[model samples]
Target chain A: DQQVKQNSPSLSVQEGRISILNCDYTNSMFDYFLWYKKYPAEGPTFLISISSIKDKNEDGRFTVFLNKSAKHLSLHIVPSQPGDSAVYFCAAPLDTGANSKLTFGKGITLSVRP
Target chain B: DAMVIQNPRYQVTQFGKPVTLSCSQTLNHNVMYWYQQKSSQAPKLLFHYYDKDFNNEADTPDNFQSRRPNTSFCFLDIRSPGLGDAAMYLCATSGTGDYGYTFGSGTRLTVV
Candidate 1:
């Protein structure tokens, strides 16, 4: 089973609409979570992050909400733009000490139709 | 921009051929990692180096090996290429203390 799961493979929304992407985790020990955006021919970039202590973090048009009890999290992009069309990945850090590697979910592709 | 560079982004090899993908980072991070991404799947961590110490994934094949000769350069070596090994290989680096990684444009390996 995937430790982190992105159930939706593809999501399409019109420009200026809210795009919500969801993720679930099976591991309760995950203390940190992150979201990354990737474009074709380019590597994934760090977008935002949240700690288990807080439920929400907002960075401009993007906000990440975490629900520890449900073992779920979501990335919300407000007024989605055509430029926002890309693959999004959710990641959790394994407790592998100081140089821990991140475990990622199969990415979700967002299509913001203009 | 602290960029991560991958040489020979596109590579083609015979089934039994050996191939090496390279990555270099300007970030000067002490931790560097190699990941393999297949079609319709997330990037999987193959192994990593914390300075000179090598850490490998348990599921990674014996044919797959990695080397970090120095802090700036890392190489992923495939001793005998197999059809299943054809995929995008990514290199990433992060601060040993920060753990926030920066990734490079991947090397797409095609086994014919």
Candidate 2:
């Protein structure tokens, strides 16, 4: 069974518009969430993350919102640029202790058309 | 500068041959992880090392094994690879206090 789910396989947006990618998790024990971005032939880079204690965290033009009650989280990128086209993955640690290791969701491919 | 480095970038091995992939981290993070990713799929954790303690995922195949000789180096050894083992292998590291992980450019393995 998948612990994290990115039901949407892909998302397309026009340049300078807002792009929203959604993710859901079945495990309630997850208290920390992270988002990663990847380009072709490259490793996934850390984007942004939110502790369950906070409902949202923003970094530059990227914002991540978490809804613990709903077991869902969303990433929002405003003024999306062509360079933003890549795969986005949502992840959470299996536990919040010292041995925390992440469990990733199937990535969502984002295409920003200019 | 890359904090994590994976060697060979690409590797091709014949069926039943043993292969070893290496990863080194400059960050000196306390934790190291090995993850396997098939095409268009999520990265699945195979194992990890917390300092000298090695932890393996329950579902990881016996064909796969890992060794962490020290704080900065980790190795993945495939005893006998099969065609189905072809995939991108990723290495990552994180400090205990940090929630975000730094990943190395994966090594793509092609088993023939």
Top candidate (lDDT): 2
For model 1, how does the per-residue alpha-carbon lDDT over B1-112 read when each residue is reduced to its tens digit?
8889998789999998989999999989999999999988989999999899999999999999998888899999999999999999999998857746889998999999
The global C-alpha lDDT for each of the candidates, from Candidate 1 onward, is 0.92, 0.94
Instruction: Give fnat (model 2).
Output: 0.58
Indicate the residue-level lDDT of A78 in model 2. 97
TM-score of each: 0.97, 0.97
Q: Going through the candidates in order, what is the number of backbone clashes in each?
A: 0, 0
On a 0 to 100 scale, what is the lDDT of residue A111 in model 1? 99
Off by over 4 Å in 2: none
After the best TM-score superposition of candidate 1, give how far the Cα of residue B23 lies from its true spot, in angstroms.
Answer: 0.3
* TM-score of chain A considered alone, across all candidate predictions: 0.96, 0.97
Q: Given candidate 1, what's the lDDT at residue B65?
A: 96
Residue A70 miss distance in model 2 (angstroms): 1.4
Enumerate residue pairs that collide in model 2.
Answer: none
The residue-by-residue lDDT of candidate 2 on B1-112, one tens digit each, is 6499998799999999999999999998999999999987999999999899999999999999999999989999999999999999999999868787899998999998
Residue B109 local lDDT, model 1: 93
| Candidate 2 interface RMSD to the true structure | 1.4
